[model samples]
Target: MSETIALSFEEIPYDWRVPGTYVEVRPSYTNLGVLGFPARALLIGQQLAAGTATPATPYRITRLDQAKRLFGAGSVAAAMAEAFLAANTTSDLTMIGLADPGDGVAASGSLTLSGTPGASGVLALYIAGRRVPVTVAAGAALNDIAAAIRAAIAADPDLPVTASGTLATVTLTAKHAGAVGNQIDVRLNRLPGEATPPGLAVAITPLSGGAGAPDVGAALAAIAAEWYTDIAVAWTDSANLLALTSELAARYAAMGRLDAHAYAGLAGSFGQLAAAGAALNSPHLTLIGARASPSPPWAWAAALCGVATFHLANDPARQLRSLALPGIAAPAQADRFTPTEQDLLLRDGISTFDVARDGAVRLSRVITTYQTSPLAVEDTAWLDVMVPKTLSRIRYDWSGYVSLTYARHKLADDGSPAAEHAEAVVTPRQMHGAWAARCKLYERQGWIEDAERTVAESVFQRSASDRNRLEARQKVRVIGNLMVLAAMLQFEA
Candidate 1:
């Protein structure tokens, strides 16, 4: 009189005797293998008053134009979106835009022209490492040259700066109001065989005076209950990074189980980056250093994480070395880190990037800023970005299988006599077998090593304290990345 195959009854009533060949549909998803990870990324940045999107609101973005509309052209969000889309266009992306701080002041700089040129030549000006050329005519007035510089800068709406010409000086003002603007560098003649026009002298005054970063807390809080695997943060300030580090740690806790990693880029010298990296110790945060690249560091951060997201989704255990970050500019050779410096940086916990032969920005090996454990002891458990990625996928796969297979199942002792076709009667022994099978799947996928030993040593039993609870202590050794190989060559004499 009872159906043991599946107790998930709905349409078929127990008292219905006249019905012939009546069937109920109960879908089972437990048979599926390790499912695909739902990779999602979030871009957090400030929006300009000219933008239509409301501050602190999150919106899904598939195209780059949408971010420009929401955060304004040349906005921090727009740069991040542009870079991310270049690296991975198909990943699910959400934007959380915040208004500028009430007391924020935009950074400003100047390029003053002096001396008269007897011969006309093109004057190359670099802002944020991007070239803005100003053509000069023979015997042109300095004031006119400054005006031309302003025109060139204004024509490009995506330069992250606005320009105004006063007499012989062209003033550049950051588009956003924040201390982040101060890092937008100003320089000239970055390319080989490039030089100033004859008799023309241009004085470069770097951007400064930007102050008051917005409360990124509001933007971060907006991600509540959402799983953003990778966050492209616009601000790299210590306070903001600390908030993200804490938030990610909390999310990765057992109670939360919604782990996230945040990426940010900083433009500074080797010493500066070393000092900055030394101060941070977080497994969930990654900071990249940009030496002389024209693009902002935030853009680099988005591009780096965006590129990694695609690879990590395909294979969580895969190494991300040498992955090309499309649309991200690599620093010039002179500004690039030497091999020794790179090694130092990697040890210092700052992610490093190198330039390819084709002038593309490529990751050497991305790493988190986690050097020491909670007890301040030296640790490398969470050093590489791949560790958390693999662990997250493992947890995801196990949780998926358990949630689907054991839904509403009656728990019992290991030797309990289950009814015929007892699909709803689950025993500890059955759970052990299920775990072993899952571990085999993990091993086949190359995510773990020694699947048999992992299951054999693991424990699964009914809880002694809680009559209805089943406790499982699982242990799986994650495979390591073959980052180096060394062999000795012996002479056969």
Candidate 2:
């Protein structure tokens, strides 16, 4: 009934007949009279999930500090991440070359403004990639020309590389090679005991090649590592775990019970064992805990349970909970079997517990068999039973289907039942509330066609839209409202 809380009575057409004059037949159903999932059931469900051994700690996300610790301080990767975060996206360096008279080119030898040679004894230096003229020294020798060029480069490594010997003419190379003006700096290194490195009219030219920036692979890797580590820590926090547990429990509460298919739908995995659940009309419930990797022993056990095949250690203890009553329809009948919270207890006297079961537990398996006899056929109407099983664990496969077992019941020395009993059970993953919520959103967005299409596709594909569907619909609604508002304003005007 809780599950159908949102479903309108109009949606479910029911037949009614009047046998007595006092009351109308089924006078307007009272909101389905649906009860929220019982707290015991949820406790049992959580217990079922907790039955298995705790999961091995999950792999933590990488952290900046952790990465630094692993890689080292001031390492290439670390530095890259630190510095590259601020790298300019648009700025670039350009290289250009200058040609001078020393590269087997003639110098215009005159202080004259025009083509008058030998007029004023002025030596003209030819620098490439520019129209400006550089004047020769007043009494400069060939060496002084080369020396001046060297001095220019020594001042700035960003200067283009230039050479001026006959065999190795004054050619300047850029630190970063590229097209003209792509150079960063040029340098002039002085050799030992040469009084003056010729300050020749050297042409400074930028080289073409290798002027691009460094790849950011290392930086990205460092950042990723840091991000993951932080995520891992947050995920493992106790507060977060408790909150998630409650949230997931509430989701299950929205649904009356967890069936195998529903569990698979919710958890987002469907392996062979999950398929096996589909094979049976009444598959077992499997409650899961801890977001762990698939290869753990508990996971294997969970998978086995999915197929009803977990090799439970022989539990010699005969401490099963009280058998449930079957075929009880009215609230009066249900009250007899529904024990108050104080009545249940663990062997250690712990009262707090959660219960989840594989199916509608109107009666115990034994009680069902007893009522199945031919003599009881008429009495055994369509009533269902509710049982309280203390489950300690549920296991799962890679596909997220659960398998489970109960803790061995404790017995008294005289073969009488002990004062306290521990019931072990496993419940199925109840991720359906989330999925159902999404399906509702998708339908609202007029994506019913897409929803059906996805359902027909593989299960994994169907799960892919769960998170995005709601957001997509919200976006659609926003746009639709805006359009309507604009149209209404236009019409008013």
Candidate 3:
């Protein structure tokens, strides 16, 4: 005999299932680097204040005094000003700066005054790029002439030096410390009168005492263990560039990050700069060079860094092209290259500047051929600036998606009906679907070529031996910038 239980007609049902779409969280990119500073900053080497581990937070600097404290007042300060101006030409931009507790060695020199002035005479002296004029009254004493010269030199802050003197000689001391002070040239114009100006016999001392190399190693170390999209030093020295490139590559490898790029300036003939770039043998480093000009070569490098940072930050997946650099001028040199010579430079992996039709100085195109070799066949398309950047962005995006998807789903390894259903959510098919979705976004934005076969080929797969492991491979096609054009016209009767 079995006992039967009666159930109520009305009943309530409860749902015990997880719901909603499990979307992934994406990380934003950070663009920052050291772009400008002067010869003085190099002399300071690398020093961080005690108890401080990293540079100050990245920000825009509006005052010269602030720049002077970080980079020192001189060519470095001027470079920063130019970078900021060019970067903010079309839109407002800010740059990151490093602070050091180091000091520079001020250069010192002196000029001796000889011959006396019979009647009113003029004495002219040139320092750096500024001219100082001292007027002597009839029968003026040497002390009076020295005083006038000191006042004139002191009035101009750009000279980077202060003037002091005794009764017959004037001494000039660099206002800032560094080896760059040694390059200052002093010229005393030849005067016409019995009271002649300082001649060859006048005896002028060249400025000296500047010392120290840029402490890039320390600066990089201070930035905290993180990823930086760009790292630039307003220096064009070969040794410095080499150090920076090596460090950047090693850091990227260790951290498993591939977004860092290094920029450097070199001063010489086109061939010389090209040779330097080849010797570097790094795709991570981009070299910009200009012919020897009166203006510092590093100035152009700083401007390029600023422009590159702005473009990369605003559009990480696009190429930088045809952007106008207002107030920026091409390097003026005595040995300007001919059209053929300029073409040769481009062939040797050097980027050139030109005056655009709109009257602005702009970059013609950006390229990187540091990996060219006879052993392996590679196309010039690999050297395009946007190609690698876009590829990196895609890789990062795909990686983020996979990590997030795995974190939210848990499935049993046992081959059971329930386990199989749960695994379906993250199976190879699902991964392919996610990849195709991302590719569609890229294609719609015109960054890559879109095709059904291409999307199908980019699917992800799981390794047969390792149930916990998955692999994905994708080929990205990039649209390059239009750099050159050729056309022919025909007339027929």
- Give the best candidate by lDDT: 1
lDDT of 2: 0.22
Off by over 4 Å in 3: 1-64, 75-78, 89-153, 156-212, 251-255, 317-319, 326-329, 333-335, 356-360, 369-381, 403-406, 410-420, 451-453, 491-493
Preferred candidate (TM-score higher): 1 or 3: 1
Cα lDDT tens digits for candidate 3, 273-381? 7676556555566666666332334455556666776676555556566775554544433445556766666556666666555536677666653556545543465
Question: What lDDT does the true structure give each of the candidates?
Answer: 0.85, 0.22, 0.55
Stronger candidate by lDDT (1 vs 3)? 1
Q: For candidate 2, lDDT tens digit of each residue in 367-481?
A: 1111222443333221111111111111111012211111222222222222222122111111222233344443443323344344333122112435222111111111011
Residue 358 in model 3: shift from native, Å? 8.8
Q: List TM-scores for all candidates, in order.
A: 0.94, 0.19, 0.67
Worst 10 residues of 3 by lDDT: 35-44
TM match of model 3 to true structure:
0.67
Per-prediction backbone clash count: 2, 78, 9
RMSD of 1: 2.3
